[model samples]
Target: MKKISFIGMTLLFIACTPIRNTNIKTNLLDNNTFELSEISTDATYGTEKNPIQVGGVASNEGPKNERRFLNALAGPNGEAVTYFRAGSCCPIKSKNDPFGSGSVMLDNYRVTWQGAKDTVSIYINMYDSGTLKAPKGFTIKK
Candidate 1:
């Protein structure tokens, strides 16, 4: 009974552990990288006042690669920004597209920076022509 309990506990621990993918390469426009001090996905999207989104399918990149690329963006004042995977964008059917010829997946991420006064939201596009770089007026940590 004790052995069984130990095995069950070990399995539970492993199952509950969060896995971090270290093999993903950073693919920001300028090779920019940022340390995530805090991250959350509890925000709305597509609203009139706070309309921020980002991301789309890359030719040879998957969601994991896209996330790694986005992890490198910093806040306006160099504060750690939060990422929210809002959803996908319009669908495109192209037989020659790398992301499968039937549907083009565009990922939308709502990036937010919590400042002293208030929170700011920025929209990002990860479509075919999406570029991974800090938006205008925003700065990433060197």
Candidate 2:
């Protein structure tokens, strides 16, 4: 009876343990493409004092794009990185020409660098212009 109880407890403990994703080393957004206007970094995660945000329009190419972009970022020591979509801001609208144009599609992402002790939250905004630029303190490569 005691042997069976011990085995059951062990199984329960194992099952309850959370699993971490390890195989996140490939470009998930290989097919999807978008031009990044600016990239910014903030020390605070999410707080009133130092809000986390990006400049320009925020937009997403959908789930595939988000996954690909997040996976492509490397940690300080080239570690694998994972990300989750935190939220988004209101979409801006513009009207003038036949096709109607607007700017600022901001998207927020919470990025985690596997094997690293710190995590970062960033925002990616897709602008109408086909240009990519990094903010004063941040840099991005495509």
Candidate 3:
């Protein structure tokens, strides 16, 4: 019936609307990709002690935002960067917890570039948004 079709169209419209046009808060290459523009000189910025907070998880878009951030980085001297999810660890309290559990776990990504002797771990928090920056020894892609 037309009533059912109207309801379906309404849902579709709502689904396509962005949860938060946070592209203004953080540079974006696309709806799902983050374009990093800064570098963190602080040694602990991306370490286990202080993870990169990419957020968007409360909107069910955390994992995608995480990859977008990683994809926007290069090596310290502008070499192509590659990374993988090492695992999730270090649960911490957050106001953006999607589950209302008051805590969200951090995701660890091991990153490296050619000629690098060893991979470095980058800690990321997908549950809370922050001004994203490349970790020390990494560079932002142009």
Candidate 3 backbone collisions, by pair? none
- lDDT of all predictions, in order shown? 0.49, 0.45, 0.85
Order the numbered candidates by lDDT, best leading. 3, 1, 2
lDDT by residue for model 3 over 1-142, one digit each (tens)?
A: 9999999999999999867433336778877568887798899998867888887776787899889999888998999988999999998988777788988899999999998999999999887777898888999877
Candidate 2 lDDT tens digits, 1-142: 9999999999999999976322222222345433443454544422322332222222333344444444445555555556677787645542211234543345667766656565566655333221223322333434
Give the best candidate by TM-score: 3
TM-score, prediction 3: 0.79
Worst 10 residues of 1 by lDDT: 45-54
lDDT by residue (tens digit), candidate 1, 79-120 = 777777767665554333454656554556666667635544
Q: Count the backbone clashes (under 3 Å) in each candidate.
A: 9, 7, 0
What is the TM-score (0 to 1) of candidate 1?
Answer: 0.45
Error of 1 at 139 (Å): 1.4
C-alpha lDDT (0 to 100) for residue 39 of candidate 2: 54
